[model samples]
Target: MEQKLKLWFTEHQTEDYGITFRVNHVYESEQTEFQRLEMVETDEFGTMLLLDGMVMTTDRDEFVYHEMVAHVPLFTHPNPKSVLVVGGGDGGVIREVLKHPSVEKAVLVEIDGKVIEYSKKYLPNIAGGLDDARVEVIVGDGFMHIAEAVNEYDVIMVDSTEPVGPAVNLFTKGFYSGISKALKEDGIFVAQSDNPWFTPELIRDVQRDVKEIFPITKLYIANVPTYPSGLWTFTIGSKKHDPLAVAPERFHEIETKYYTPELHTAAFALPKFVKDLTI
Candidate 1:
C-alpha cells in the first residue's frame, strides 16, 4: 500500500462541535494587523479562506451569500446608482453589485487591506470586481465611513465577518443608526446576521436594533454550507421600500448563479423559530 498523508483543517465552529475539511494544500497563513488570515486548498470546498480560524468563504458556495446580500436590497430600491459595501474585502459583494446595470458607482471600504490583497491573489474570481471602473476601493474603517456619510449612498451592504475583533462595531445599534443617516431617503441596507442555530440571540438583537432604525425591517435566510450550521440569516433595513412589496416589473433578468426573481420573496418566508426572533 502506498503511503498516504492524512491532513485535515478543522474549524472549531463552537466549543462542542466543529467542521473539518480534508486539506490538499495550505497556501499562506499569517496574522495581519487585524486578524489571522489563512488560505487553503481543500479537497471538499475547493479554495477556502479562513479568518481568525473561522471559515469565511469557499469557491464552491460563495454565490448564495453574496447574491442574497447584494440583490435583495438592490431590487427593492427603484434605482440604486450609488452603493457602499462595508468590510467585504473579498469583493464578492462588489461583483454582485456590478451585475445590476443601474449601479453607477460602488464603493468598498475594508479596514484590513490584507483580506483584499490575499483574496485578489488566491480568490480572484470572487475578488476581481474590486478593480472594476465603477468600483472605488477604500482601505479604512467602515464604521467611520458610515458616520461620515450623509445621505450619500442609495444602497449600503454590510458584508462583515462575524461579530468579533474588528467586526464588533458592525452589529451595534449605533452603527445601524449611522447606516440610516448614510442612506438616501429611499435607500436600503442589508447585513449578515450570522447563523441562527449558533447565535439566535445575535439574530434577535440585530433584528430589534434594525427595526428601531428603519421603517421597513425584515429577516431572511440563505443556506451557506461553509458558515456555522449552514443556515445564515440576513437583516434588511429599508427607509421607503419593502422587499416583500417589489413588483414584477421592477425585477429584470440578471446573470446570477443563486438568486432569481422567484426566490427573492421566498427567502423572506422564515421558519417559526426565526420568525419569533423578529418579534
Candidate 2:
C-alpha cells in the first residue's frame, strides 16, 4: 500500500486569522540569532520565505512588492546616485533599485547574515543583485547605521518586517528623525508600512510621524498575494521631490512585471478606506 501525506505551512498573522499554504518540501528551517527563518517549497508560491512565522517574500509575487517599493521613489527623485537599503536581507529591493541608471552606489544594511546567506541559496532570482559591484552588503544593525551616517544617501529604502522584534525601531519617530539627518538635503525615502487592514493604526502613526519630518509625504498601495491581507502599503517621505508630480521625461524604459510608468502615480490612488488611514 502506498500512502501520501500533505504538509502545510500556516502563518498565524493574528491570533484569530492566518493563511496557509500546501507545502511540497522544506528546504531550510532554523533559528538564527534574530528570528526563525524558514524556506519552504509551495505549490502556489514556488519558494516561500518565512521569518518569525510570517511571509517575507515568495518566488511568484515578489516583483510587485520589490518594484513598487523601489520605482515609486526612484522616479520621484531627479538624480539619486547613492542609495541605502535598510533591513532588506532578501536583496529583492536592491535588485529593483539597480534598475535605475541614476543609482551608482547601493548599500544594504541587514542585521541577520543568515537571511542573506540562505536567501542566495534558496532564492537566487530575488537575491541576485546583492553580488553586483554597486552593492555593499553590511551584516550589522541598520538602526545604528542610520544613526551614524550624515547626509550620506540620495535615497533610502527601508524594506523591513512588521514592527516586531528587530524591526520595531524602524517604525518609530526617532528613526524617522534619524533618516532625515542621514539623507542628503533633498533625499527621498520609502518604507513598507504594513497593510492597512490589520494595522490601520500603524499606517496612521507612520503617516503622522513622517509628515512632521518631510515636506512631501504620501501613501501608496500594492497587491502582494502572500502578504497579510493581500494588500500592502508603503509610506514615502521626501524633502524635495513629490512622487505624484514626476515629469513624463523622468520615466525611462525598465524591465518590470508589475510597476509601469502610468502605474507610478496610479498606485497612490488608494481606496477610500485605505486613504482614511493616511489622514
Candidate 3:
C-alpha cells in the first residue's frame, strides 16, 4: 500500500504563528520587477494570488474587501464623479466604483504592471472592470500620482497591500497629506490599515495622521480569512462628508455580497480593543 502526500502553503504572519492552506496546483510563479508573484489553486479558497509570499486575494472572499473599500466612501460623498484607485491592480475596487452611476472616470495607478497583466488573465471576474470605457489604467507609482494631482479626485481608495516593499511609502504621513491635496473639497479617501491584532500601532498612526488632515476620520472592520488576521481594518478620511451620516436616500441598489446600507454603520462599530487604536 502506498500513502499519498499532501501539498500545503503557509504564510507566516508572525515569527510564532501562521496560516496554512492546502494547495491543489500552482498556476503561475514568476518574479516581477517589484515582487515575487504566484497564483495557486486551493480547495478552500479557489484561485489565490500571492505577492511576496503574502496572500493578496482569493476567489472566495474578494468581494468583502472590495465592496467595503469602495461603497462606504462613495455613498458618503454626495457625488463621486472622479475616482482614483491606488495599488488595486486586481481591479476588484474599480469594479465596485463603476457601480455608482455618478462615477464618470476611474483611474487605477499600480506600480507593478505584472499584477495588472496576470490578474486579468487569471482572475477575470475580479479584474474585468479594468477594460471598461470609464477606466484608465496607469502602470505608475500611486504616491507620485497623488503628489502630482491637485484637487482632482472626488473619491480616492488606497487598495494597497500591507505596508511593505513597494507599499512602505504609501503608509507614511506625507502620503496622506498628498492624498488630502489630491482630493477635491468634499472628497473622501479610504486606506486599508493592517489588522488591529497584529499591527495596532499602524492603525493608530494612520488615524492620527489622517485626522490632522481631514476633519472626519473613521475606522471600519471586515473579515477576511486569508489575510494575516481574520479581522481587517480600514481607515477613512473625508474632507467634508461624514460616512456615518450618509443620508438614507443616498443608499442605492447595488450588487454586493458583504456590504449593505444597514451594515455601513455597523462596520464602524469596532470592538473595544480595536476602537482604542482610533484615539
Candidate 4:
C-alpha cells in the first residue's frame, strides 16, 4: 500500500513586507509525542521547519541564504581567526565560514540539540559542514553563552530564526549589546534579519538597535527561495571597519556561489524603499 501524505494549512497571511506567512499542520503514521509541527513558507521564498512536521527549509533554493549569510561578514574582516554562530543548528552557516583559511575555530551555539541532530540526519547537504574538527558545538542558550563569553571571537554571526518564541531575545538591544561585548574591539558581526518585504518593523528596529551600539551599521539584501518573500535582508554591524570598504583584490582568492566581489559591493546597494527604512 502507498503511504499517505498528511499536511494541512492552519493560518496564512501577507505581512507588510510583501512576503506571505503560513502555518501548517502535518500528520504522520506513527504515534509520537510531538505529532505536529509548524511549517512556514513564502510565495517567492523558501520553506522552514519549526518542529516535528515543521519544514524549516525548502527545495526550491537555500544556497543563497546560507552563502550570503556566512561569506559576507567573514570576507568583510581583514582576518577572521575565530567565529561564533548562534542558532544555526542546521550547519550551513558553519560550512561557509570554515571555507576561510584564516579561521582557527568555529563555535556553534544552538538552543536545540535535536535541531542539529535532525538536520544532520535529514538534510545532509546543509548539515554536512558541522563535522569539521575545527567546529565546536555547544548546545545551550545563545544569549547566556554570549553573555558569558570572554572577548575571544573575531566574528559573530547571529543565524537565528524570527524574532518570536525563544529567538525573540536574539533581536533585542540587550542581545546586540551582548554580541558587541563578546567580540574583540575590531570584530565584525552579521545577522539574518527578516525579509524587509515581510517584516519592515523588524528591519527598522534591528537597524536602530545595532546603530546605537556599533560604529558602522549597514543593511543588505539577498534572494532566498525558502524565505517568506523571494527577497531577504541581512544587517551587518562593524566595530571599526565598513564592510563595503573591503578592497576588490582581497576577494579574488575566495570561492563563492552567490556572493562575488562585485555582488558584495552591490548587495549593500539597497533600493530606495529599503534605503528609506535605515534612516
Candidate 5:
C-alpha cells in the first residue's frame, strides 16, 4: 500500500499585515512548457506562481512588490529616455516605467522567453505592458547585454530573482561595474536588494559593491507578502542625480499605488540597523 500525500497552509497576522505560508502539496501536474515554472492558488494570498518549484510572487499582494520595485527609481529620475530592465520577464517593471511621461523607450532583457510568455498568459495584469510599442523585449543574458552596451541607457532597472542559480552572477561586483559602464553619465541604476529581515547579508554586500561603482548609492524598503520575511529592499546607484533630491513640483503629476513622493523620500530614511549595515 502506498501513502497519500497531503498539503497544508497556515496563516499569521502581524501588526497590520497578514501572511499565509503553504507546505506539502500533492502531485498535480508535471508540465514543462516555458521556464519550467509552477502556478498554484492559495486561500489568502490569491495565486502563487513558482519557477522551478520556487516561489515567485503571490496574487493577493503582488501590487505592493511590483509597484515599489518599478516606481521609486523611475519617479526619482526627471527624464528617463532610454531605460533597460534586466530579468523582469513578468513585465511588472515595464508597466510601471511606461507610466512616466518622460520615458521614451523601455527595453526588457530577460534570459527566459518562456517566463515572459507564461506571465503574459497567466498573469496578464503584471505582464500587460510588454505589448506596448515603446517597449522592446530582448530575450538573452542581461549581464552579457550590459557588458556589451556602452552609454546606451538613461536608467537601468534590475528586477531579478534572489542570488541563486543563474541569478548569482547578477549580484557580483563585476556586474555592478558593467552596469555603471552601460549607463549614460547621468543615468541611474536600481536593483532589487534582498529582504532586510531574512537576507541582510545580501543587502549589505550589494550595497557595498554598488557604492564602489556609483558616486551615490542608497537603500530603500518595501513590504511584499510573497517574498521571504515579507519585507524587501531596493538599492539605487546614481552617477549624477540623488534619489532623495526629487523636486516637490514633480510629485503632483506622478500617480502611484505604494510609492508616493512622501514615501519615496521616507523609503530612503532607513533605521539605524539598516543604515549601519550599508554604511
Candidate 6:
C-alpha cells in the first residue's frame, strides 16, 4: 500500500506568490454577511482562523500581532483609561488591553457578530477577554462608531483587515480624521498599515494621512508569520504623545510574549528601504 499525500490549506497572498500549511483538520467553515470565516487545526500552527481566505491569526504566533498592536499605542500614551478597538472581533486586542490597569473599559466594535461568536468558541485563548467585565462588545460599523464618538477614548486600535469590503473606508484619510475627533486631547492610536514588502504604497499613504491629522506620527514593524510577507507595519498617531520620547519609567511591566520595553523603542527603527516609503 502507498501513503497518501496530505492536503494543504493555501492562501493566495498575492497574484505571484501564496503560502500553504499542512491541514490536520478543518474545525468549521462558513460565510457570513461580511466575509468567510474558518477555523482549522494545522500541524504547524495548531488552531488557525481565516477570514475571506486570508490567514487572520494562528494560535502559535498570535502573540506577535496582538502584543504589538496593543502595547505600542498603550505604552505610547502615559495613561489610557478608555480604549476602543475597530474590527478586532477575535478579541485578541481586547485581551491585551485588559492587561493595563489604566484601561477602565475596552469597547470592541465588529461588524460581523459571528466572528465574535466563533472566535470565542474556536479561538478561546485569543478571544477570552470578550467576556471580561471591562470589555464592551458592540456589533456595528466601526467607521460609524468612530464618527459618533467625540473626545471619548484615550487610545484607539484599528485592527482591520486588508483594504476590502468593510475595511476599505478604514484606510482613508476621512476615517483617520474621524479617529482624531473621537479621541481625547491626549489620545493615541495605532493601526496595522499592512506589510511594507508588498504594500509599501499603502503604508506610505497611511503614514501621510495620519501625519496630517495627528501631531505625532510614527511607523513600527512587527514580524507575523501568518500575515502577508511576514514583515508587518503599524502606524501610530498621537495628539500629544510621542512614542519615541517615552521615558524608561513609563513602561512599568506587562505580561507579553513578543513586546518588551526595549522593543517598544526598537520597533520604530525601520529598515532603510521601508523608511524611504515614509519620506
Compared to the true structure, candidate 6 yields what TM-score? 0.97
lDDT of 5: 0.79
- Compared to the true structure, candidate 2 yields what TM-score? 0.98
TM-scores for all predictions = 0.98, 0.98, 0.98, 0.85, 0.88, 0.97
Q: What does candidate 6's lDDT look like per residue over 131-169, in tens digits?
A: 999999999999999999999999999999999888899
- Candidate 2 regions off by >4 Å? 1-5
Candidate 6 has an lDDT of: 0.92
Write model 1 residue lDDT over 95-131, tens digit each, in one string.
Answer: 9999999999999999999999999999999999999
> Scored by Cα lDDT, where does model 1 land?
0.94
TM-score winner, 3 or 5:
3
Cα lDDT tens digits for candidate 3, 1-279: 854238899999989989999988898999999999999899899999999999999999999999999999999999899999999999999999999999999999999999999899999999999999999999999999999999999999999989889999999999999999999999999999989988999999999999999999999999988898899999999999999999999999999999999999999999999999998
- After the best TM-score superposition of candidate 3, give how far the Cα of residue 69 lies from its true spot, in angstroms: 0.4
After superposing candidate 5 on the true structure, give the runs of residues whose Cα lies further than 4 Å from its correct spot: 1-36
What lDDT would each prediction earn against the true structure?
A: 0.94, 0.95, 0.95, 0.77, 0.79, 0.92
**Ten residues in a row with the worst lDDT in model 1?**
2-11
Report the error of model 3 at residue 249, Å.
0.5
Per-residue lDDT of 85-192 in model 2, one digit per residue for the tens? Answer: 999999999999999988999999999999999999999999999999999999999999999999999999999999999999999999999999999999999999
- Displacement of the residue 196 alpha carbon in candidate 2, Å: 1.1
Worst 10 residues of 5 by lDDT: 23-32
Off by over 4 Å in 3: 1-5
Residues 220-276 of candidate 4: C-alpha lDDT, one tens digit per residue = 999875467667899999998788898876674666668777888899998898988
Pick by lDDT: 1 or 4, better one = 1
